[model samples]
Target: MKKYLLSIFTLIIPIITFAQDSTAEKFDAVFKEYTGWFVEGIFAEIPFTDDIQIPWVLFVLVGGALFFTIYFKFINITGFKTAVKVVQGKYEDIEKHGVDKLYGDQTPGGNVFETIKDDGADGEVSHFQALTAALSATVGLGNIAGVAVALSIGGPGATFWMIVAGLLGMASKFAECTLGVKYRDVGEDGTVYGGPMYYLSKGLKEKGAGGVGKVLAAIFAIFVIGGSFGGGNMFQANQAAAQFTKLFGLTGDNAGMYFGIVMAALVAVVIIGGIKRIASVTEKVVPFMAGIYVLAALIILFANFTLIDDAFALIFEGAFSGLGIAGGLIGVMIQGVRRGAFSNEAGVGSAAIAHSAVRTKYPASEGIVALLEPFVDTVVICTMTALVIIITNFGGDSSAISGTFMQYGVEVKEGVEITATAFDTVIPHFSIVLTIAVILFAFSTMISWSYYGMQGWAYLFGKGKITDLIYKILFLFFVVVGASISLGAVIDFSDAMIFAMVVPNIIGVVMLSPLIRKELKKYMNAINKKEDALEDGATDLVDEM
Candidate 1:
């Protein structure tokens, strides 16, 4: 596997050297020109009016979320308590109930091969690790850069819509992740292969939509691989390298390349260990990074406690009135929904990939927990970031495109830099801390995405050691390319690819949602039973006393 990976890396070395050596100006144009069409196609908008054009994919996401929210009778609200308990391992004993189904005959085909018998649980990772792994992927730059971008265009009103989107998005997360586990394929060695690729194909086949499922699965796999390369690998590496260079005053043509190489090596070390390793690393890093960032936001909020109510008022008002922005009400909604989807990643089906790897007999257990992602990511974390930005920008000129005394002091600032500026506003010299957070966010996101992309790669290619090694090397190469190249078009294309996943993912999810509801019912019943048993035991103990 190592030799095969090395041979593949050798093949890409020339391309990397050429890209690295090429004039930055020339390659930027070349990259944009080559990749421009994909971006245009994926983000193509429908003209709702002379001034309003909404991307169709955004509608796809919103529509699925709305449908699921209603169909599940607002599981996002009803399931929240269960989700919290599940993540807390309250029903840990129930994990054993599903070991037979996980390792035994799951489909009509039965066991693909004799797999390892596990005494404790049938999954590769615990529920927390899966949640963190998925969380690490979504709760990165989007929570930082994307929130700032939305606020700049959509104003405070965008924050309100973002929260609404995140709330509705919970149902979508529940549906897809439930299907992820239900359709997952467990190998003889206990390796789990799941996600939209499996559920779209396998679940659809079971539902008599075999041909549709195959095509959607293939398309989803292809797009997921591209997404992994663009958004997951390169975009992350590029941003991290950029942050590192800016913070330390690193300069030179090769600075980003060097940074990318270091990141690639670190990522390679973790990803080579597969999901278990990825989960372990994320379980630690996600909480730490998120906690620090949230803590800072809390401090800022408290510091501006008097302005909190007024900031929310502006958010509500701006959302409806659009604050006289270009697109008005429609525009703010688009920006909020787009950024919300980008941050929390509901309906995209990526979280389902991570959640599918959890140790539980009831797939719905992870599905319930999966709903927390949007709440934590967009509702909690992104909201904190937005509040800080809004609060810092308070009492300043509302008319200026970019207000004076704002972080960048211009009409527009770069992405995550806006958040840094917000932090620095209350706490002087906090940009250094923000920069570290950004790098950690980027690093953690890349590792998780590496796992996501590799799953797609493995699904498309054979799930062999050589295939895995080859994908890892190629993925590492993209990390370097992403850091060094200023490929606006490429990044745009990759962002589109990430959103494009919603199409097939939602389709499969919509079809398989009934199955998910059934699973949810079963899981809930078990939870009730467990609670009843515990209550009875408590009552008996009280009587004896």
Candidate 2:
């Protein structure tokens, strides 16, 4: 597998490098033309109302999340404490059926003994590990660069809708992750295989909607595979490489290609080991990187504490007043919600692929845990990024700096640079630190997403070491391609692919919601009964012990 991957990588690199140079020049020309066309189109039709300016896609996502929220009777909110306890194993007796034991001294897939030996008990990685793995994918450049772009176009008001969109998204996360565990397939060797693919196919089949289920699942898998290659893997490496080159003032345009190769090589090393290794790496990298970035944001926030109120006022005013450029209030809201959805991906169903690998028996346990993702990624992290930019502009003529294409006063050029500028404004030399943070965030996100895409590829094709290798190789190749080239088209296509997963995933979730409800009831009942027993025993112990 390694030899085959290396051979493919070797052949692809030079071709990608040459193609990227040509593509970049072409992209610059086309992007300029397209931006004009896009802006004209926006003005032509959507005479933006603040409330109505939000895209139909955002409505679908937010509405879907709201539906799940009500359908599950606010499980995302009500189950938070229980979810934490489950992750801590306080409710283990309710979730685990029996004592977990690793296969005892047996070879891989050899016999019953081997199977037993490999069939490890539940809780492979801790609930925190699972959360970190999922977070690693969602909390990347989108929170940093993407939010800056949104705020620039949508004005400060975008931040308000971003938070609203994120809050509602929690329910959607709950639904998909619940189904992820509910229908996860366990292999004979105790290897776990699960995701939206398994649940969508199996759950719908159970509901006697087998044909629809299979078709939707297949479509989702295809998009997921594409997304893994494009947005998740390539886009990450591309952005990281670009930022790295920029920070060091690397000269040759092909520097990005070289950086991509290094990034791809590192990814190949980790992914070759499969989910166990991927999960382990993310558990460490995600927390460390997130902590560093958040701590830095916090420091900036404190340094500019007096400006915080003004930032909030501007965000609220811009969101509702539609006083800036673009289509109006609605356009600003659309930009924020659209970007937020893209960032955290609550309804898109990609995160379920990672969360499904958890060792828990109760699918709802993971569902409840999954809700925390959007809060952390969009609500907390993205908000901090937005606040930094807003605070920087406080008491200044932000409109003077707004670029030609931007609708609001926020600047559009060099999003990462703009963010770094904001940081540097408060703390000199912070740009260097932010550049490093961006690289780490991008790398961690790409690796985790590579796993997501591989699972989708295996589902669509067949599961084998060969198939896994093919997916990883292709994924790495795209990383280099994304780094070296102007990938507006590719990113657009992948962005669509990511959103496209929403329809089928939501269909499967809605269809299988009854099953999720059933599981939730079963798990909750078990918890209730266990608590009752404990209370009764405690009363008895008062007389006995």
Candidate 3:
């Protein structure tokens, strides 16, 4: 497996390198043309509302999130405090209580912090570590660049729908992550393997739909692997490279290619260590970078304090106004929801890969934790990004920025550059800081996604050292390819792959919701019993972290 992956990597690297010099312009032209076709052929036809056109992917994602929100009775809302407590180790005993009983000498399959520090449990990382890993992947340039694009096309009204979509998405995240932990597999060496793939296949088989479940799971795994390679790794590198080169005024055609090689090398070093290393690095990087970015956004907001009320008014007005600055109410809503879904990845099921590594006996515990992701990524971070853009254009005519005049339906102008301009408007030289932030965001995303893709790769081939090495090598190679060459086609296909995972993933989550409900009930009962016993002078079961 290692040799096979190495050979493929070897072959692909030369092609990518050669293409960088020989076919760079050709590739860019082809990709642009392809993107136009994709927009017209597929994206244009999807209906956003009963009367307006939107992408079908948006409907699937939003509708699924809404369904999960109702089915779970708003666990995202009810369990928010409990989720914080669980992550803080307040309910550690409940998660660890039945572990020894279930597996005896062998470690149970899931514990939240196994990745950061090994303890012979099913968990591959701490709850916080897992959260960071997931966040690193979800909260990338999308919040900065993608949100700007959405606001550009959808208008300030889009921000309102983005928040709505994110809130609903919390429920979907909870459902899928709960299933991820509940149906995880623990290997002989105590290595934990779980995700939508495991639950979709195993959970369905348990329900007497083995054959169908296996096929769907296999398809999902394949797409996930592709997605990890393309959207998760390559596209991230590509964008980061572009930003870096643009900031430095690197004019040569091969400048991005040169940047790609450096980025790929850095990615390869971290990915070689697998999820444990990736989680460790992200646990630190995610918080630091997020703190910096959010702080900058806050500064801009405070500096432009008077515009806050106006921003809100515009957001509301634009959201409901029958005549949007561009399309209409539905158009803005679609843009907001699409951007929000893309940024937070609530229904994409990528977070399941990270959540599966969490150490917990009760699956609902992680589900609660997972809900916070969309809230933070989309509801909070993406909102801040939008506010920066909207607030920057507060006094100006918002319609001027809308891409309605362009033949290719409305799009944002230089989204990354627009975001940088917004930041620099308030804080001088902040673009330098933003460029650094973007690079970190991109690198962290690539590393975490390397683990996600590797899991799928391992599942398809085999979970051996060789297979692991192969996947990482191929994944790192793509980082360079993504940076060096134009890959809009690859990015589009991979974005679709990521979105497509939602189909089988949502099926598994819905199918196994009963089990999730059962686990939630059991965990709640344990918590209640513990509280009762404590009132009666019983010893507390929680272990201090």
Candidate 4:
């Protein structure tokens, strides 16, 4: 741990020294151009029409989501109630088997075992903790900045398709997370290791596709590691540092760099303890940040209750008609789907890593709970942000052409800035509050992604303590780099790496989906039998009364 901390300082000192030597603008320009060149090919778009070019990655994600929805017989809709019950601990007392070995031998002196064990528990955390951890990763910048950017570009109509994509994405989340749990590795010491990596390799090997599984798992691990550095660590730190500087009126050539160092240090404290620590923090932070952000949005919506109907009217109209946006209907739909996938991350298979650690014997139980991620992230929180933006119309021109507005004599840009403007318009000086929310959102997301990327790193490079420590240190360094550098190319490369996971991940999911269906059926049977037994007990008691 000391060595890891030393490594972080070693990386930071040189970066700060270099930033001191060069002007910020010059540094940013070079970084952006270089990064863009490296990642442009991977993130290249496929032209569907003259004006509607969707990234091939988005197509892979959307296609997998749609296929899973049909294959699972719309489990997203029919299993919603079951998901809620599972997360609420309704089935916690269900008898668990095959875990006696997890408990060590104890002398028969009426003494309790001091060592904590799963005791038939297959995972490390509760259902709710697992869901919150996954939600923390997905429900961050995408809900704030991603939504604002989409609405600005696609207009009010884009909201309609975003919701559509989220609904279908629930099925995709269920499929991958179920596999995550089924193929997971449970150490004798109660450590849990699961994700696309394990499922792709282990699960596929069980189906006589060992060769293909090994290749896919390797590719997924590499992409996941890159994504953790770029999208999960750096991009998040960059946005948070930018927002913090803007809110406090901080001015300096290295302001962002300083902020990134501080942020990285804080993140290092949480990540050093591994997933258990990350889950514990996220369980608290996800609900608090999401609740505060949502409550604020609700207050804004309630303040303008009269315009609620009008906002919905515009959303539906713009979605179908394009409402004079650059690309028309097709463009609006593309924006909505693209942004929705980015925000909820249904087909990315990253959530499966988080959900796989859930303390449940039934893998499908976690899968059912996993479906709620997209619903809460996109359908609920993101919708609130879009509504706030649409109702305020950004406090100025509502036109879609420019995608910019004026606020207090300042040019309101896109992303979180635009969302912040919408909040400030409804309640004066609320930008400060929005700024805090963005920071919390970024912090929670960075820590969660660190765990995710570490899991991948461990899988590929041997799960030694040394390897884990090195990866964590490298991750923290990227957090600082993301804040200090204006690497458009760097961020693009990382974003592409994240999207690239969808290709190999979905292939594994598609092949293993039949097994997921079997697990779902087994889980449903247990739930139904329990319900029936409870109903019979209630009837007998009523008769006695």
| Best-performing candidate as measured by TM-score | 1
Question: Considering lDDT, which of the candidate structures 3 and 4 is the better prediction for this target?
Answer: 4
Give one digit per residue, the lDDT tens place, for model 1 in 209-323: 9999999999999988989999987888888999999999999877887787778778877888889999999999999989999998999999999989888887888888887
Off by over 4 Å in 2: 21-54, 98-124, 323-326, 397-413, 537-545
Off by over 4 Å in 3: 1-14, 22-44, 47-51, 99-121, 396-410, 541-545
**How many backbone clashes can be found in candidate 4?**
3
> Could you tell me the lDDT of residue 236 within candidate 2?
82
Rank order by lDDT, top first? 4, 1, 3, 2
Residues 395-431, candidate 2: write the lDDT tens digits: 4355422433333544476678777878788789988
Separately for all candidates shown, the number of backbone clashes (residues 3 or more apart, or on different chains) is 3, 9, 14, 3
lDDT (10s digit) by residue, model 4, range 378-437 = 999889989998887733455433333522212235587778778887788888888898
Q: At residue 409, what lDDT does model 1 achieve?
A: 20
Please list the C-alpha lDDT of all candidates, in the order they appear.
0.83, 0.76, 0.79, 0.83
Candidate 3, overall lDDT?
0.79
Question: Candidate 2: minimum summed lDDT over ten consecutive residues — where?
Answer: 536-545
Off by over 4 Å in 1: 1-15, 23-35, 98-120, 396-402, 406-413, 538-545
Candidate 1 lDDT score relative to the true structure? 0.83
Model 2's TM-score against the true structure: 0.86
